[model samples]
Target: MSAILESADIDRALKRISHEIIERNHGLESVVLLGIPTRGAFLATRLAQILKSLGNEVPVGTLDITMHRDDLRLRPPRPLLSTLLPPGGIEGKHVVLVDDVLFSGRTIRAALDALGELGRPKTVQLAVLVDRGHRELPIRADYVGKNLPTSSNESVKVSLLEVDGHDSVEITGAR
Candidate 1:
């Protein structure tokens, strides 16, 4: 375990995110939540629950952009990718894209491509738990839980309760 965010702190962070999202949009109507693969999916689910509790009938789903990633060959081959297209798709809908961390913004780029194949969305806003500040693309999240300053040699690991049995973020040095 590295010295980083604790489980309780993460829970609080997510709760803050949920609140901010609702506040920024001024109520979730005709809203849709779409997530990147892995942790993004978990975050989206939680946000959906929060919206539902607030009486917002927002739609939620997951997106897998494994093949669409720009670093496809740079990283290990990721088979068994999931390309889930929403039931009604995103045509003219307000879609909120969720991801665990915002790094080079390449992942969001790939997600946009994958989203394009499904349908056109009226608006697509990004929501991330952490923004580590070193973007390579022209993208910035509309909603961010935390702005964590980090070095290029560092790595960020976000653990969620739904899968990791804990909610926290770990920053580790590249070894």
Candidate 2:
């Protein structure tokens, strides 16, 4: 496996993404960040902390899209994660869906369905740590840390300090 992003690299990318988000939204007013479960949740929390330090306290929450996935029938039973929304809910707020990686785009699709059931938001955007670029759906990320062009045979692994005890992004598989 080859390491593409080290700890410092990950940190820098996230910070840049945070700044872009602030610039695009004209500040974090009425902005709500909902992280897709697993690594996405941790990334969202970190982003919230970064945004808070930057002077705006944005609400961060987790969105479990296990039930709304399109390939549910293909996989075995999976445990459902908790769907936590910040106070005031998602109604009329700009919801940003954060995830670790954006490959197939199905996860984001499921997230949209899950979000629809919760409440109507002013707008919905997507943010991903890595975009490997093998989109099965038309979805795309609004905020991306890094765009790593990858082949279908290769795999990108993102290790975050929150879960993996370190930070790094590695790519493995036949080149």
RMSD of every candidate to native, in Å, equals 1.7, 1.0
The sequence of per-residue lDDT tens digits that candidate 1 reaches over residues 1-175 is 3747787666677778777778877787667899887899888888888777767767789988886887778878878455565677789988899999999999999999988888889889999989999999999999887898999989998988888887789898865
lDDT of 2: 0.93
Candidate closest to the true structure, highest TM-score? 2
lDDT by residue (tens digit), candidate 2, 68-141: 99988999989999799999799999999999999999999999999999999999999999999999999999
Best by lDDT: 2
lDDT of each: 0.84, 0.93
Per-model TM against the reference: 0.91, 0.98
